[model samples]
Target: MDELSVKASSLGDNLSAPDGSDLPEPRRDFHDEQYLSQCSLKSRDLLLLTCPNLGLQVCWFLLMSSGTPYLESLDISKSITSLVWLTGPIFGAFAQPIFGILSDESRHPWGKRKPFILCGASCVATCFLALACAEDITDGPTNAPTADSDSTKHWYTQVFAIACVGVITFAMQAYQSGVRALIVDNCPPQQQAAASAWSMRWNVAGNLVLSTVGFLDAKRTFFRPEGNAKFKILAVVTTACIVVTVGLVSYYVADSSQNPRGKSRQPLTKLCWSMLCPAELSKHWNQLPPVSHRVCTIQLFAWVAWFPVLYYTSTFAYETVLPYNFARELHEKGQLDIRLIEHAELHRSSSMLYFAFATFATSLLLHMIEHAMPAFDHTQPRIWFFSQCSLGFCLLLTFFARTGATATIIISVMGASWAVAMWIPFALISAEISQPSPSKLGGKTGWILGLHNMAMSLPQIVSAILCAVILGALRWLNIGDGIAWIFRLASIAVFYSAYLINKL
Candidate 1:
């Protein structure tokens, strides 16, 4: 028998032994049968698990709400602004997998995952503080945007932003991989679906709260007076909230022992090197279960199709469709004095609110279906592919949508599908990778999760660089509707992705 099975068997033997001998019947603990029954969390545990996710969702929304505007204020051209915005995902993509591997290999008295979580939270908080302080350091006598703008430019602001994203990404990967492993370790196989459901529910709850916050922040009152100062205050407050919530959850949630006394094995590194080497890549390549390889390939393609559309959608709606529609309406009504920026902000806020509601409603519907039927077992890869295709198609429709209301509805539908696409494939990949095993349990778990993150991150980097190039090229061509090219390219990618998913 392998290590875990042997250890479990030994424990069973010790517990059931007729002992008047070496081991007397261990005094029955308070958790006899009743506690065990109660421990298997039903729907309630899922809801509680989502608390940490809520904090994360808020941080994400806040970042998305302000990031582009903040970049624009830096006096950078629109094209370069898009490129600079890519710094977060590029750094985060590299950082997350390494952290995941480290979490897998770590051995500490407190636990392997908790240390990373605390470190990540601390880093994110520090970054937000620095970002908040940027204007204070740069403000000058005339208060005309500074002469030493390049020198006075808060390099630290960008540094902190990248750092905060890196740490958060690291912490997220570690906590998710470790906690999901912990669930598999502690609970029976039958209960895993419930755990997955709970995790998704928490994600939706967090998204809902963040979306609401974004909507409120878009109001004139919030952005009009002392705009920079107000945003900094909000950032600091939200960062603290995330750190505290994640910290508490990590602390209280029990971690399964990394190596049971008699069951401990060689370190993960030694095993990984011995089993998976360049020389042996072909020999052992086929050893991995076919299902896992298929899922990973499908995931990579789906992300490539999805992320460009998502990252650019808000900007497109605000800059292109909204301005055109508002300007046309004003011209028709003979009121030519409407401010473009103010109108754009309103449209942006409205779109965010609508997207939020649609996402929450869809999540609720999916949850109810899972609760009632409990076996909504569609193939995840197929579902994820179709969702991404749908998003691309919807985005393409925006190019031709004549009415503002129709465009808004199309964008909202795309947003909702994108939200579902993000998590479902991840959930499936996590389930597939964490399947019961004898050898290299920790290493396999970490590698699978790390690869999954890499898939998500790499696509963002490509999208950022490619989109900037496309936009720049289209602008050079004087194609007034340059943004439409982006949506069309995304549709083509999605169709390619659909083919890849079908092959898988």
Candidate 2:
């Protein structure tokens, strides 16, 4: 037996022994069952568990909402922008699971999760800061937009920027997986649902903040910075928030060393090798519980439809809707207006803000529904199916949208799927794997979660590959000013995901 089981067995024997008979209800008071099941956390602990998510979400939103737009402003080709954006998902595909396995086996004095969390947060902040000033920092010949230089120097700056983004993306994955594992470690099995609910709530809060900042920044109301300068300012704000929030979480949360339930860890080298070689990890994947199997399948299909919406929405809006409107208004004058580009930026930011609000509102409604009818559980496969259908419908609606407002409204409706997509898979998976039972071998929690995360990573890789194809083999289908068909494909994938959820 493992140490946890041994201790529990010893406690049971002592409590029921003759000398202890005088003690009233020793079994009730001293049983390990009660101790493990009743490990309820206070509100303060929940807040600590959630703060890092706030910072991380802020950074994530800023990057996702702004990154490609910033690149496009520099007149970078769409293909190159997608390639730059691909860096994060590609790196994260390896990084999250690897970090997860490493943290699982970690015996660091400061704790397994905390060290990575701190390191990741610091790297994220530093790299994000670099991105904020990428224009200023990349002094190669490419930066001089109006000046002439060898194509090599210009490409050098672009490559450097992409590299920085890749590093930041990799670091954020480490921070994300670490925080997720820490929450799993701290919460007992029974309370995990509540923990996940609160987690979703906090995530919405972060989105709200992110959207508000994005809206304000786009209007240039929050800062005087023009062009990419505004992103630089936002980057500063993002860095400070991550540093302070992650620092507080690190200082306040106790180390995992204080809790021992599992067996000796596998050698780090073995885990590393397994991650590097699919054959080594395939057994673990095949052996996953039925519920995990279901959740992973759902997640994989869900993201295939979701990521394109996220990565390409702003670009689509600019090319298909906003520019046309701008052209229509300027047609009478028979002159092209440069100011339309600025207006398009504002419109995209507004759309982002609306999207965030939709998520926030959907989360609140879902919470109320879950509370009023506990039978309608948040992680129910049918609920996911319905949510996916609704999201797919919204994406399909975008195909016919003739104006920015119509597109924005359609995306706002998508917030429902977005919230469920973010919340359900993790909650369902956590509930299945995070039982209080002692580990028969070392806890497989890390690798388990890592495998599920790979589902997310896979879609990104697929999307990147498809992005290249859409630009090449499918160029003729760019019927909606070059990016419309991608939405239709995403819609089909989402409906298929919903269908898969029904099977699950």
TM-score each candidate. Answer: 0.78, 0.86
Q: Which is the leading candidate under lDDT?
A: 2
* Candidate 1 structure quality by residue, lDDT tens digits, 1-504: 121221122122223222223234443231233322222333333444445655555555666666566655544456655655565566445555555556555566655555665666565556556655655644434556554664555554454444554454444444454544443333323344555555555656665665565567666456446757656766776676667667665654544235433344456665455333645433333344465556556655556656665565566667564554456567799887646665666666677677777777766766676666645545555656667677768867866765446656877887678566645665665455434452333334544555555566677788777777787787677664555567777777677767776675
Candidate 2: Cα lDDT at 225? 43
TM-score of 2: 0.86
Clash statistics: count for each candidate: 1, 1
What C-alpha root-mean-square deviation, in Å, does candidate 1 show against the real structure?
A: 6.7
Q: Report the lDDT tens digits of candidate 2 across residue range 133-244.
A: 7766766434455535545545656777777888898898889888887777666565566667777777777778767877887686666446677778778878888887
lDDT of 1 at 318: 72
Q: What is the lDDT of candidate 1?
A: 0.56
Candidate 1 regions with alpha-carbon error over 4 angstroms:
1-39, 76-80, 137-188, 260-289, 322-338, 378-382, 438-443, 502-504
